[model samples]
Target: MDEQQRLAYWRANTALIRNLLIVWALVSLVFSILLVETLNKIQFFGVPFGFWMAQQGSILVFVVLIFIYAFQMDKLDQKYNNKK
Candidate 1:
């Protein structure tokens, strides 16, 4: 890849990472902590939503995010001719 392609690839990569991090923070911090009181008003299965988020929701989201990152990065790699 030339200089321009390299720069664009890195930019796209960083943007993907940034967006994923934002989602991670929103799920792990905002939903599980800041919005706990409001979320608790709702129920997930038999448990309170807030309690579920703190106990399991965040972990589930994290795992899903990992898969999403891997999937997206694979596409990104193909786009940049960087596939393994």
Candidate 2:
């Protein structure tokens, strides 16, 4: 890739990473910690929603995000002719 192409790819990759990190932070910090109390008012599978989020929801979200990132990056790679 040319220098300009490399720079564009880098910027696109950075943007994707930044967006995913934001989602991760929202799930891990906001839902698991900050909103735990309010979420606990709801129940799922006999467990408090907040407790579930703290224990499992964030993990699930992270896994999902990983898949999403991989899928998106594949498209990005194709767009940039970097796919292998």
Candidate 3:
């Protein structure tokens, strides 16, 4: 690819990373402080929704997000290198 294509690819990659980070932050905030009472109204197999989110859901999402970001970025890197 030419320089213009490379720049576009990088920009797209950066946007994906930023969007994922925002989603991660929102999930963290929801579990940590924002929607505790509303979340508590919904039960997950006898567990309080808020408590479950705080204790496990957020962590799981974060871990999954990390893997997803890593995998996507790795693919982008491989593509860029292959073009050379």
Top lDDT prediction, candidate number = 2
Q: Rank candidates by lDDT, best first.
A: 2, 1, 3
Cα lDDT tens digits for candidate 1, 32-66: 99999999999899999999999999999999999
Global lDDT of each model?
Answer: 0.94, 0.96, 0.85
Which parts of model 1 have CA positions greater than 4 angstroms off? none
10 residues in a row with least lDDT, candidate 1: 75-84
Deviation (Å) of 48 in candidate 3? 0.7
TM-score of 3: 0.80
Q: What is the lDDT of residue 72 in candidate 1?
A: 94
Question: What does candidate 3's lDDT look like per residue over 1-84, in tens digits?
Answer: 789878978897999889998988888896646997789899997998988888888999999999999898888878677444
Question: Clash pairs of candidate 3?
Answer: none
Give TM per candidate.
0.95, 0.92, 0.80
* Count of backbone collisions in candidate 1: 0
TM-score of 2: 0.92
Query: Which residue window of length 10 is worst by lDDT in model 2?
Result: 75-84
